[model samples]
Target: MSSPEHDHVATDLLAALAMGDDPAELGLDADARDHLASCPSCTDEVAALRETLELIAAGGGTTLTPPPPSVWEAVKAEIDRPAGAPAAAPAPVTSLASRRRGVPTWLATVAATVALAAGVGLGAWVVQPDEKDDATPQAQVLGEAPLASLDAAAEDRGAAVVRRADDHLVLHVEASDLGGPDGTREVWLINVDGKRMVSLGLLPVGEAGDFDFPERLLDQGYRIVDISFEPDDGNPVHSGTSLARGEIA
Candidate 1:
């Protein structure tokens, strides 16, 4: 088994590769390459990340054309504008108590949602099971839910939960918009009551893939599916930022 430190290094390298970093310049040692070659999960993750990068490159070419010279001139003009009146002195620092008291109810709700997403993302990646369970079975759709975008920037997403004759559960996910290359998108199963939850696994960008689902989740009534952005924080907890979510019927 690989040590935690080794796994962290591998994840870092994978993140760099996903962001189109040059492998030669990354200075990967022999042990790191060996681990990548030997670990199926890491290898699959690298392939998925590379595929996402390619898709992004292909779609981004014409959409991200550089601005014309006139745009740059306009920007320069704004920057050269005359200074206005002197700014007021900075406000004194407030106590934690005062800050909490000043927060609006809606802002507090948003903060709570962000915290929940972060916690779920952090906890999901640590429990990834080995790939030995990949005995592809004829999956039957047990239930599904239409994932709703949690923010205006998020694109449409969807998920389906299927069950095999052997009682194995498989989760199929599809996302219309891609996430940042440095971060990963993870799937979770949350209970309808919103108290209990479990991580399914990382979701591939711009493609659909099936993952091994814990049967116990259904027994425990974890039917709400969520996808959230997770950074490589090396902490096994959610990041409290959800992109999309839905309830599985």
Candidate 2:
């Protein structure tokens, strides 16, 4: 709260705490340690978090990936084709002159498309990053296991772990022989009621990132979480394959 630099320090400390690591050993220089000692809120948060992570580690190691906030409430959206819709309603092919009667000239449309392409190119050029930023992937990683697990999971198949916080859950997942792009992106969230499946973003991918669940969703009474590789091209249905799953005993 004091300074933007301190706030960045706080976030780094919190991330270390969330990962169940000793912040002192996380390459934090002297200034951060001094800042952490004086910051009571962060200290209290770290203390409580470490206890919960310890308990999670005490449980069986082999576990399933937990569901994210969007997993519950409803399944993936489906496009309902009309019950008796025709298989193919092909558009009538027409010559350029016939289409010219309907709207602006082809030259105008080409100019517009060229303008759009130039705009996109300029946007990308403006956002180019330095080496560190370039090294960081822009994609979201669904699980929160430490980087060590990620390095190991690269070669090992069927290794996934799930951990529970006081009001949220974290998943660590990895696999090799999974499935399709869209279907594989889908995952199943199995609770006592039934299955509230979810998509784990992508499969066989890891960067040791973490995801947080909504407190309200945890109160809804769903416990176990499982994920699968689902393709993202279209269909929003579960892949019916469980890459990894976990639940408390």
Candidate 3:
């Protein structure tokens, strides 16, 4: 039917296309962009409210709020009710727009305004991390090691950590089967005076990896870490064939 002032300019252009904006270049109302371009159920309710705001932005630490003004006047009185009536209860936001129905009442009022203003759930939500950002800072560990097996009769083993994040540094590494000898495994750091080294690159075929280094390479001594094998013959050096080693401490 479309009339309470064209469903309040199509629920304020579906709340500016549910926040990721662009209510058709913000000019809005060309009859709600010609009924959202001749309505295919308002373009599948603007692609299910932009896939539920991209699953609440891939739920990374969660945050979403907008849905007040009496939940956009209960989404413009559930888009000027008419189809099958009975649904006017939702206002403090949840009750997922009074338990959905034939969809598009501006996508159950912006998915009950971002699932009850982020109290979560309705496709996915995750939360927990707020207590004033719990004073933020994490990832520190600056050193660790274990990677044995420089083959005194091979028993294999691995690990090499060295965190620090957001101030960079990284250098994870991992290994277990120790098995190798035919080509390309590389990853190094050397230079605890054993004649300098750097390579930190190819280990990934599940030998596990992380590498970032250069906080002045652990203050220029590069504390060991090795893991060579390289035999594609393009030789970038360091093929002193070590299979594992560690030192980070």
In TM-score terms, which candidate is top?
1
Candidate 2 weakest lDDT stretch, 10 residues:
119-128
Q: Return the TM-score for each candidate structure.
A: 0.41, 0.28, 0.30
* Model 2 lDDT tens row, 1-249: 234234333332343445655554565555555666676655664554444345456655422232332321111211133455432322111112221222223322322222222221111111112344346544333333211112335333344445565555655544344433444343334555664643434443542324445534445544455555555557667655554445423
Candidates in order have lDDT scores of: 0.56, 0.40, 0.63
How many times do residue backbones clash in model 3?
0
RMSD of each: 29.5, 30.0, 13.5
Alpha carbon lDDT at 131, candidate 1: 38
Query: Best candidate per lDDT, number?
Result: 3
Model 2: how far is 57 from its true place, Å? 35
Residue 177 error, candidate 2, Å: 5.8
Across 92-157, the per-residue lDDT of candidate 3 in tens digits comes to: 310112222344454545455443333222233233333445566777887887888875764557
Q: State the displacement of the C-alpha of residue 128, model 1, in Å, after optimal TM-score superposition.
A: 43
